[model samples]
Each structure stands twice: as structure tokens, then as C-alpha cells.
Target: MPFSSSSSSSSSSSSPDSKYNLTSAIRAQTQFLTHAYTSHNLVIASYMKNMDNQPPRHEGSTFGHRVIHCDREEADRRLWNDYFSEYPKYSEAMFRRRFRMSRNLFIRIANVVKGHDNYFVQRNDRIGRLGLSTLQKVTAAFRVLAYGIPADEYIQIGESTTIESLKRFCRAIVDVFGERYLRAPDANDVARLLQIGEKRGFLGMLGSLDCMHWTWKNCPTAWAGQYAGRSREPTIILEVVADYDFWIWHAHFGMPGSNTGINVLEGSYLFSNLANGIAPPCHYVIQGQQYHTGYYLADGIYPKWSTLVQTIHEPRGPKKKLFAMMQEACRKDVERAFGVLQSRFAIVKGPTRFWDKCVLHDMMSSCIIMHTMIIEDERDEQADIQGWKEAPTPEVDIARDENIIFQEFLARHRQIKDKEAHYALCNALIEHLWE
Candidate 1:
């Protein structure tokens, strides 16, 4: 019992030492952890300092952007010295061929467009650098439409700028010239057309009707089935009625259907005013039967409607042969117009690169309007068109009750859709052409 007591006393005395040893070890570990944590913090601070030492970058964009110095003012100077100066480097014919318009006409168009849209006017960048001049912008847009090339082909003008310019230019042309140039045939116009038709052997023939197709390269995949016909190529159709002078009086575009003038004609506005009884007076006698409405000479694809006159398919007699020859010869007016239109604005001739249908519509409308303007300007140089221009516009009567007007409109609509009138007109035309 005394030995046990002595051992317990010894253990009790050594316990304090063992506890001190353990506490020292824990303190050492905590010190080491603190040092390691300080080192980690220092490393993180150094990494962040390195990050801050790098060059600042633009927000939402990466560093190392490229900049090409373009002396656009010099480009404008060169353009003026080459084309607009008193003694220019290019000839008038060269100017007309390259620009697809006269210098005066280009100037007039530029001035008008600049006035209509502020985008055409020259402006400064945020850095106070002068941007492209009016001449440069218009040239880019016009050349793109005239050549069907990429907009970046212009000297120093970027593709984005040129594209924007082309968009605005097309819109301005539509707003400025669409009303005056792209119009239905009025009384004077109908009279002049009838006079030309009389000389060509048809009495009430207004113009030739046809349709053309434009390949849509960027058509949406969802619409491939609807727009793609037998060719399996997505295309948009344009239906037009043009005269011998390349004047397109009626145009219905953007329908995806057969280019044979039948499907497109179903929804066309060619005879809207006529069927509504508000059309210009067109009274002409064919074989002792007077036709109060004019007709368009279409190919065999169109329906037998009084407003549209088609040629005989298999003519077994001499009269039909003569009529077919004359009709076919005259019906080429619209085709020739299509050829010239394609030749002028090669954009429509080539595959369309735009995806938006509304943009395509604007582009087409602008092209057609510009085409009609060119025709009028060119025809104005002739003495005969001047006489037609001098003809007085016919007066329209504004007096009519609503019921009577509606009745007349229905009557005209029925007359336009009359198959008997179509047959009678065809027979009379055959006899007239034979005579």
C-alpha cells in the first residue's frame, strides 16, 4: 500500500510536465499555420498586382484591336478630280456605263437623297475625323447595285458602311421616286398606250404581262419547301406589265410561285382599279364591239380573263398564224424590259444575299423605280416622248352615289372576269391582226 501511494504521487507530479509539452506543441503548430496563411495571402496579392499591371481593354471586347488608317477625305478629293471637275478623266459614255446614269442625273439623285436622308450627308466621327463624303457613299451604293459585287470592293469604304449606305439609299429612292415613277396608267398614259397599240395592230392592248424569278441564296431553311419549285432552288417571282418603251406600269413582286404569270397573277393588283370602276377611260371598238377596259397581252399560261389576252396555242388557220406572229412579236416588250432591268441592276440578276424579305422588297422596289426613272430620262431626250408628256391629264368625275358606285364596281369586276369577252376579244384580235 505505501509503494502504490508513492507511484501515484510521482504520476501526479509528472502530469503537469506532460500537459506543458502538449500545449507547446499546439502553439508551434498554430504559429506554423499562421505563417503559411500569411504566405498564401502574399502570393495572392502579388498575382493580383500582376493582373493590374497589364494594359486596360475595352469593355465587352478583347484587347489588340486592329486599326487601318484610311484617308477618306483624300478619296473624296480624288473622286471629284476624276469625275466632277471641269475637265474629268472619264468620258460621258464611260460615266453612263459605269454609273448606269448620267452625271447630271447622278447629281440630281444624290442631292435629292441627301436632302431626304441625313445618312447620305457627310458627318464626323466621335474622334472628329471626317467620314465618307456624299459622293463616296452614293458611289458605293450605286456600284454595288450596278455591279452585284461585294460592297467592300470600293476603295477604303468598309463593308459595313457600304451596306448601311445601300440600305438608306434604297429607302430614299423608294420614298422619293416611287410615287411619280411607279404609277398606274392614267388617261394620258392610256391614250398614249392605245396609240402605240393601234400602230402595233391591237386596239385596247395596254401592255405585255410577264413574270421573272430571282434566286434566293439566303432563304430560310424553313421556307425551302414553299419557295422551291421544280428547280428545287428557292426563288422569288416578279410579275410586271411593261410597254415597248420599257415602261413598267404594273409590278407585283415577292411571290414564291411559277414564273409563268398565272400563279402570280391570282393576287396581283394589275386590274384592281379597273375592277373597282375607278380606272381611266379606255373605250375602243374591236370588230364593232367596244371594250371599255384595256387588256394585257400575256403568254399561254394565264387564265382566259377579259383583262388578259393570250395567244392561240395551236393555230391551224392563216388568220391565227398571222395573229400569233404579231402577238408574239409585240409581247416581247416586257421580256426586253426584264433583260434591260437585269443588265442595269445586276443585283436582282444575281442570287440575293440578304435574308430579310422586307429588305429584299425595298431593294427590288428601289431597282424598279430607278429603272423607270432611267427610261423616262432617256426617253425625255427624244422628241416623241415630249409630245406624250405635253398631253393633258384627263379629268375624272367625282360625283357618284355610294350605291351606284358600288354597283358599277361590281359590273366592272364581272366584265373583267367574263370569259365570253375574252373569247370575243381573242377572235376580234385574230381578225384585226389578219387584216
Candidate 2:
């Protein structure tokens, strides 16, 4: 009975209702297979395709560059006559004022930069017309840096050429002069600085440490809040250690403006050497107690770290007040360095126009390098700089060999962070400065 009744049951199961459900499922599967991508996925695929199809900016922009054939040869002749000639229109004094360096220094820099990059060499463009002369290019770059002017100040140089020249100049300066100028204090330097600090009543002080903010006018919208400081302006922070002279011994740039001195210090490796026992020996006697690390005079915002000396707040007595006065005065060395740097190179003084933080970093580094170069070149003229520049540099190193003592390193690190030492040093300084 079951076998004979199966035909009717089977036929009923295959009726139109069942047939319709099967057909519906098939149609949904077909639609999904045909159009699997959602709008968001489609948008992403199209963007990737576009990016793949387009040439890069640096290469693509040159495809139809409008070559401006200015009187570059005449410009070169005039530049040589005014500066490099035996007899010239501008005197050596004017050269220093305008170039922000001596004539000989500028020539040496130009020659070195030309060797590194042939773009500085006088050459003909595609059509065989003489392009911007080396002097023209260098001068244009200097003018922009010194004055913070738009790139098109010179009729001979187009805006693009001027901008390119300036960028190349910054890169070359950083590459060529960075090592000599941007170096941390070596052993000889440490010794000299220690002696100078002793003379100034700072005993073991390396220099003054401080932070400066450079406004970022073209900060990305997403980063505006992160880069804005107390002034509510988008900016970047620079942490520098500067000596009594405007020589910046150490620099760390590109911190978001919202950061304080502590944040920048965390981001920098300034204390890594001290932590590892590779820092230059900064031995000094304070109240007959021997200390191992040099200290920087920092502001009150910084933490009470042993290596940072902050002025006493609300000093009640003549001794405390005088100590505070002296501490604050010495701490202004970094601030004064910042002022002199900005005064010399107006580009960093004004709001930054470049969007790339790396470019800004390079620009800042190069400016500091050139500033030091100028300082060294004219050290003879700087009355107070005579002693430190002449300090004998013996080849002394903290890490005598590669084998390190982990225990001693840890002990040194602990000493660096010891708040008790910080207080003790402050008291010793108060007494020392009083006498």
C-alpha cells in the first residue's frame, strides 16, 4: 500500500507551492553571484584602480613643466661680480648680512653641495637654454630662508625652481653638515662645558633645556587638535639643549604641539646614554659629594628628575631668592638660543607652510646646522666663546669596550632618576651659589 500510494504523495509534494520556493532560492543565488560587491567595496576597488593608473606627483608634474628661460647666464655673472669676484658691488660686511654667513663660508658650502648634487651646477635645460646658475639657485634658497619670502622673489627663478632649490639645499645641508654641527657633546665638549659651568657657578650643568613651538599653518584637519598647544594654534614642538652661547648641542623636533617638555623627553633618546652608562662622564663635587651625571636647567613643568635642575618656587630668604634668580637666568640660555635662531632664519620664526612633518624636521635641522656653522666661522668675533672653542679635546670615551656592566648601568640609571639626589643637588647649589 505504501508503494502504490507513493505516486500521489510524490506528485503532491512537487506541486506549484514547492516549485515556487525552489525557484525563489535559485533567483537569489543568481543575483548574489552576479553582483557580490557592495557600494563601499566598489568604491575601494575604483580608488585603487585610479591610484594604479596615475603617475606619481614628482615624476608626473614634470611632464609638461613650463621651462622659464630667464637671463640665467647674466644672473650668474652679476652674482659672481657682487660676491665671488675680487672686486664686487657688495662688501664683505654686506655679504655677511645678506647671506647670513661670510663669503668664504658660502663658497665652501656651495662647492660642497655641488659635489653632493649636480643640480647645483650650471646647466642647460632641455632646449639648451642656460638654466638657473648655481649661485642663482643657492642665493634664491638663502633669500627664502633668511626672509621667509615667497619663492618667486627673483625674476630669474620661477616659483617651482625656487622651491625645489630650497628643498634640495635643506637636504644637502643636513646631509653634509649635520654630523659636525648636530652632534651631542663629546667627552672634550663635556669637559669644556663642565669647566664653563663651574666658572658660571653651575658646577656640573651641561646647558639649559627648553621647548619651543612652531606654528603649523597648513596642518591637516584630522591632526589640528593633536597639534594645537595652549595657544590653540596648530604647531609642532622642538626640544633643544643650548649652551651659554647660542650653540644647540642637542635637538629633537616634530612632537605634536599638545605635548609638554616631559612628552618630548619621553620621545627623545637624550637619557638613553645615561641609562646605559655610555653618557660622557659628568663628575663634579657638590657639598663634598661626588655626582656622576651632568644636569640641565629645566623649567618647573618638567619632572623633578635628578638630571634636570629646576628653580625653587617662592623662595623666602635672600639665599634662596638669589639662587632662584641665578637658575632662571641661566635657564634662559635655551630660550635666547631659540630667539637668535628665529631672528637669523625667519622661516622657523613664522608659521610653517610645508605640510610634511619630515620636511619641516629637515628644514629645522639644516637651519640649526647652518647656525652652528656661522657660529664656528665667527667664533673669533664672539667675545665670550673664546675659552670653550679652544678647550683641548682628548680622545676620551665612556664605553671603553663593548663588554658592558649591566649592574653598573642599572645603578647609573637609578642615580639619574633619584629624586633624593635632585633635592640634595638643589640644596648644594643654593649654598654654592650663595657663596
Candidate 3:
């Protein structure tokens, strides 16, 4: 009774019975329950928080967990500027003069490549990034032709473009510019080249021909057969014939070195049956075999053919001096052409550093074609020079002199015994006689 009496008095002091009925009392009780539950949850959360604050107990410590803090945007901008400043510049006029082509020519060519609708579909979209003008693109090509630098380096120096963009630009230029510039010599062009050679005292010389080995890097294992014999390095052998003016008359490139020189020569349309129509008359006998006419000039490496003139290795007394002089003079054209080509394109002065042979080949071929175009354009610009006007007569006289020697040799050989008999006599004379 005492406990009941205390409870009734506590309930009356709290609030009126109507003011707090079963529904209201139940709600008040629920509020207290939610608060108690929340407090209990807070205590559990505090316990877990304390556990998490302790160091992880594992096999090893996380000593190398680094937090990178750098200004990424600023670093990227700096790299872009650094790449942009690598190229050298010349006055627009100087560029035009050196290339010997009008600015319009390059612009027209660039527009054609840039406007190619199909190029837009590429995934990486390199063509869109080439910000260079037409003139700049042409100049970049010149850098490749003249400097022989890797296309990436050329583009960097020639245009304010990225290496990747330059690669695309170079490929596009080669496609468009090569078609526009690197034309095969026609009959008329061959005749003109011969005329220029004659003017330069190369008698009966259709073109000043030479062979060079362009060193390659990281050649495929399958291409071991094509490496240069002496160097034991991968290379692409190129045979080119240029005029006295250094305008390329014929180009035979892309043949593997594993192929014989004779085979390569034969495969070249420049040396094949097509040449017979364009080659000039010869004044020298080859292998002691006399032919009616036609000849090419070759170095000691080539096999003697009636269609080729080679300097005699051994001649008696005074004739030796003359032959040496003639050989020296004839070989100079090729040397000069190579020298000029290398001087302008510094990249090809030695072995390429690229790891792919195909890329290297394309780079080299494009440079060569571009160089020829430059020479052709330069020659056209200087067509009226007095040096060329007075050049052919002296060359014709030398041809006559060579013809006289040929006629004399023919007459003497005819006077000897039968052809087989004469051949045996000559072999016997050389076989036993040792210096």
C-alpha cells in the first residue's frame, strides 16, 4: 500500500491523465526507447572507432604508400612549350628560294592532303593535329630531304608540331608530294639527262650512276640475307643516276642486297630493255666483244657489257694517265651527287637509329624523291645559264676520240686469228705473265 500510494502521487505530479492517455503515453515510451537505442549505437560506434585507430597488424608495414602532390596541368603546359621550341626558322622567301618552288605549290599540295575526307575517320586523328601551314609542311619535307633526320626530329624542327603529328604529316606529304614530284624519267627526260652529262664531258654517258647502302636499324631476322657483306649490317641498296646538274634521271631502290648486283641492275627498268631505247651509242668494246653501239658507264664492281663503258684497269705508258683522268672525271658526278644529298639531309650520313626497317625504308625513299624534285626545280630555274650553253661541244669531241680508239681496236682484233683463237691468245698472254 505504501509503494502504490507513492506511484499514484508521482503519476499525478507528472501530467493530467487525459492530457497523456494510452496513445500519447505509448508515443512518449517509443521516444525514450529510440533515444536509448541511439545512445547504445553511439557507444558501439565509439568502440569500433577506437579499434580502427590502432595500426594494422599484418605481415609487413605500409612504408611505401606515397601521396603524389604535383601540379599536373602546369607540368603538361611546360612539356608542350618545350616540344614547340625545337625547330629553327628561315624567312619565307629564303625557304621558297632554297626549294626552288613557289609557295603556292606547297599550299596546293598541303590542301589536297588536309582536305582528304577519308582521313578524318582515323581513331587517333593525327591529321587533325598538324597545325603547320602548307609552306611549313613543305619545309618539313625539305628538312627530311636535306637533313635525313628521323621524321620526328624533322617535324619538331621544321614545324611546331608533335613527333606523332609529324609522322602523319611526313607520310601524307610522301603520298601527295611523291606522286606530284617523284616521277619516273620519260624518254625525253632521259635524253635531257644524257645531254647534261655530255655537256659535263661525260661522253656517251646516259646518266651518272652510282650505288649506295642506306644502313638500317633492327632489321627483321628474315632479312639477314640483305645485309651489306663488308659491314654485316642491314641495308637497302640504292642505285641512282643523275645529270651533271644533279637532277636524278633514274632511281632504282628497295632491292635487297642479298640479290646480286647484276640481278638488281637487270630488274631495274632503268637498266632493262627500256634502256636500250634511250641509251646512247658506245665507243668502247666490253670483254673484247665488239658491238655496233650503245653503252652505260659503270664502276669496277659491274661486269663489263657492250652497253657499258668502264675505265681500263691496266693500260700501257701514256694511255694510263689519260684513262685515270677519264675515270676520275666520270666518277666525280656520282660522288658529288652523294655529297650534296648527304650534306642537305644530315640524317642519312650514317646508320638509322629506328627499330623498324619499313619505317626506315619509307623515310629514305621519301627523302630521295623529295631531293630529286628540288634538283629538278633548281635546274629549271637556271636553264638559261651560260655554263650549260657552251658545254656540249667538248663532250662530243671526247666521244669522237673514244670512237677512234674503238675503231683501231676492232681493226687490230679482226686482223688476228679467229675469235676463239684470239681469245685463247689473249688468255695465254695474261696467264703466264706475272708482275
Compared with the true structure, all predictions reach lDDT values of 0.85, 0.86, 0.54
How many clashes show up in model 2? 0
Per-residue lDDT value at 122 in model 1: 88
Across 1-435, the per-residue lDDT of candidate 3 in tens digits comes to 999999999988877666669779889999999999999999999999998999755432355544333342343344334332344254447646554444445445456656652331222225444333333344455445554543333233322233333455557656766765555554444445545544544434565567777776666777766575557777777787765666665667777666656766766776443232223333322345443333355676665554444565766665444654565576667768878777666666776666665566566666666577666555655563334322222122333476775775565334321345433323322322221
Candidate 1: C-alpha RMSD to true structure equals 6.7
Best by TM-score: 1
Q: Cα miss at 56, model 1 (Å)? A: 8.2
* Model 1, backbone clash pairs (residues 3+ apart or across chains), number: 0
Q: Can you write out model 2's per-residue Cα lDDT over 5-113, one digit (the tens) per residue?
A: 9989988978988889999999999888767667668989999999999976443347765554467667678778878899989999999988899999998998988
Off by over 4 Å in 3: 1-174, 177-181, 258-260, 273-294, 355-358, 380-435
Model 1 lowest lDDT segment of ten: 382-391
lDDT of 3 at 272: 43
CA error at residue 216 for candidate 2, angstroms? 0.9
Q: Give the TM-score of candidate 1.
A: 0.85
Which whole-number lDDT from 0 to 100 does residue 158 have in model 1?
Answer: 80
Ranking by TM-score: 1, 2, 3
Clashes of each: 0, 0, 11
